[model samples]
Target: MMRPHRGLDPGSVWAQRLRQLEQRLRTKEERIVVLETENALLHLKLAEYQGLAGRSTNEVLQLYAAHGQQMKLQRSSAVTQLHGAIKRLKQDLKSLRSFALELSKDFQRQSKTCLYQVLAAVQGIQLQNEAMQMFQIKAFDLEQCLQEVTERYEKEKQKRKALHNNLIELRGNIRVHCRIRPLLPFDDSAGHSVSQDRRRNFSEKVAYAADDETVLVKCSRPGHASVNKTFQFERVYNDLESQDAVFADVAPLLTSLLDGYNVCIMAYGQTGSGKTYTMLGPQFDGNLAFSIEEESELGIIPRATQEVFRLISEKPPGSYWVEVSVVEVYNNEIFDLLAKDSYGKVFGIKRDVVTTREGKSDVPLLTHETVENASEFLHLVNKGLQLRVTHPTLVHAHSSRSHLVVTLTITTVVFGDNFGTSWEDEQTSQRLNKEASCTFPQKMRDSKSTSSSRASSPVQLEATEKMKQVKTRLQLVDLAGSECVGMSGVTGAALRETSFINRSLSALADVLGAIAEQRSHVPYRNSKLTHLLQDSVGGDAKLLVMLCISPGQKYLTESLQSLGFGTRARQVQRGQVKKKTFPVPSKGK
Candidate 1:
């Protein structure tokens, strides 16, 4: 027995306490029932006595009331009995309350222990729920990030797809043609004498003489015969057939203008060359001549107009009307030839700065007119040319002191098989496409028109909304000839003219040089001529440079320089033409 003694087990100890609490609870219940029974007996006797006093019989009832009153006095004993029972009940209730207090203390201790255990379990469950929620939130955030990445990738793919579809190339076969001027009555020997006389006076003759040298002139067309001669250069290209051949290669492009493609044709050469004659036929009217009757008379401008008309005629009548804007870049200024303004003043140049599909700003919009035929177009162009300032130099007569730009703005509408509606109003149709005319800075219009001519007339230029519809510019440029300052012996105002001419021509050369070397920055903004031709030379315009040469050995150096310019121009590759579709206005503002 003394070997080992086990401490009280937790389970047995709890069971013993529960049993003791149950015994005390039973005794309190029995005592409460006894006290309640005694109180009820005393209350019943008091009620009986009161009822006897309220009876209906007079004397007998009064006596019965006195008897009831005595019984009531005797009933006072019930109060003593009630007090004794209450005292006993109070004693039992005190014992029961003491026991209950002890039991409550034990219950409190057990409850505290149970609550701690429950709190620990609940805490573990809450931690698990929080971790699950955090994981779900992280998963949702990752899903959203993946979706955004996919959307960005899709947008980039669409941009690439659009770029892939807009690629275009020069689609025609390349051909080279030369136009020969007709022979003049002045023999080669006579021309040489006159050259010698001019040279002796100026003392500015070239080292090589025109003794055995000959000029080969050919028509621009396929079947025309070449004229070979050992004479002056100007006399060689004087024929109509020869001039026609010069513009033959560009006929297809001119036709496309009427078909809604902006086309530009430019000529570049030295002074005294056949550029003017080639572009504008030397004013000739041989309607009575039998040889001219069967043949198509071609001057570059006239032929171009005819071609435009031909293409437009293939469609319905009045379907296409060409608007022309003839402007000149004189010295370093822009002059609207068709403008009725003062000599030194001209209309401002405006262009819509648009972003092409390639995200480039090479496209420009120009303002122009709707011309009916070649004759009407020529009238406008001639008016502009007449307004231009020309001067005579010792080397050449009526030398163009500035660059001439002729913009043929062609607009074609597809009518709904109703010619009446088409011709009724030009503003009715929605603008489908827009072509830019030559984009020059408006500031260039401030330059003087001539050394002596004053700004007399005010510009009465009328603008058409149709001009805003042109997105592509068809620029035909005839640049002023580069001259040797020393040889020209220019002085006074002529000196200023010579300087401007040199500087501008030099700038043009620089641009060509930079472009030839693939320089990122070409100085097109340096000169007005360059700025006006910005579209044709560097923008999305297709350019053609015709280097007119004098085969005379006397002009060999100048001719070589002109050829060098053409070679440089050929190296420039301005991506491709970006065609823009004009959105139909809800209501034009």
Candidate 2:
């Protein structure tokens, strides 16, 4: 390959060398272009493979992310379910605990019941035995002794009541009790109170129970000297006192009724001063029966009724019976509330009060209802109260329009055989009064001996056919309020009622005033109310005046007026209460 280019002409050889070098350079360039074309194809294929792998990786990553999210949601749901289950389990556990506690108590009660039953059975078996027979006899003896003790206790109680009445007679004073009512809702009159704060500051209380037997009244006004007055009373009940407490002090007077003495209990006060509330229990709708819860809150009338029946029960069977007469003195006219029509419907009937042969006032042909038990008695009274005149006024929503008088007449039958030998009870009254030698203990012995004799002797039993009847009355009077005309805000018919009420109250005051002044000419006939209350007001009867008052300064004038009335009443000089007896007609007559 070297010899062909070496032997050519010297200039020509250089040209040939140039041509060969050009051909070699062209071949190397063509080879480089082919290699570049293959490399471009390889680059295109590599990019295609890279694009496919990248798309697959992206799909795998998305699926992995979705699976991870699904796992997270499942774990969260499991945790939430666990928590909910725990909460439900906790609630169930609490409920189960309570149930378990109640069940345990129930089981204990059942166990106690079973034990009691077993003991009762065992006691029954023991009682059938001979040794227990002796014990039973001893128990009977003990029971008999207990009964005697109870009888003695009842006698002592009656004696104590008698002593109390005697003491009152000796003192020449009437029992006057003042009761201060708490601030009622209506006390804050809408016309007076501008705001809640002002209500408290407007009228401070002016009257208060200073002690058990004294009332302190403070009269204060703007830019004036306060006038303080103190009044004495037989008893003073504060705003906090319960109805039971008020009745406790008044309960002893009821015993006098069975002792053949008249017991007059009068409730006097201004309108909205709790007179009705003190006389009848709260919410005294008159027609409805009393509820069990309201039993404890019963006022004077209901309690007195119950007391009358209780005392009657202690007497000999069929010895005493009660008859009730209810009358309301309205506009100075008496209306019988227990009057019945042909259809047996009760209504108010106008009646006239006539004077009896003994100068005692009596309502002729007034409706009288005989009751066997306290419930029947209360039912009759409630029926009468329905016919009672009541009107609403500015001072009170249910103001009494008339004076109510509920008289319970207790008829006590005395066997004449008791007067035959040694007994002094309703027997040998003339001798007992002349000698004054027989005492309560002596009377008790005599009654026992007479009872034993009656049990043994047919002669004394036959002599029991002749009996003596004595009737004593228990009068419960609820007086209408002596309120001011302007304060009552009444118009037309109510105004007339107000006038009548005021005049009647004034007449009562006059009677009291006359008695206090020892005037020979008492004005009892001046008003029907005075005439009706003749025996109890100034005669020989136990008179108790309950003065209900409001502590607010707004009712100061009325309070003072009532206080004056009560003071005049206390100063009256009534003689000792005397026993009343009526002769019974023969069986044929």
Best by lDDT: 2
Tens-place lDDT per residue, model 1, 384-463, is 67666667765566777777888765543332232223422444432222211122123323321221111111111123
The number of clashing residue pairs in each candidate reads 24, 0
Model 2 residue 374 CA deviation in Å? 0.9
* Residue 305 shift from truth in candidate 2, angstroms: 0.8
**Model 2, span 1-589: residue lDDT tens:** 1222444443444346556655655665565566556556655655664565466456545655777776556555654664565566556556655655665566566556545655554554566465768889999999999999999998997797567656777755578899999887777773443576555543568889998789999987668999899998778999999999999988878886777777899999998888888998887654336677787778899888888888877765555657778889999999988887889788999988777787877667777666767787777888888888889987888999999999887766554555323333544444333333221123322321121112211111123344456567788999999999887889999999999999999999999988888888999888899999998898877899999998887788999999888888888777666766544443343
lDDT score, candidate 2, position 162:
67
Q: In model 2, which residue pairs have backbone atoms overlapping below 3 Å?
A: none
Q: Which stretches of candidate 2 lie over 4 Å from their true place?
A: 1-166, 190-202, 285-292, 416-465, 581-589
CA lDDT, every prediction? 0.52, 0.74
Off by over 4 Å in 1: 1-241, 284-298, 341-367, 414-472, 580-589
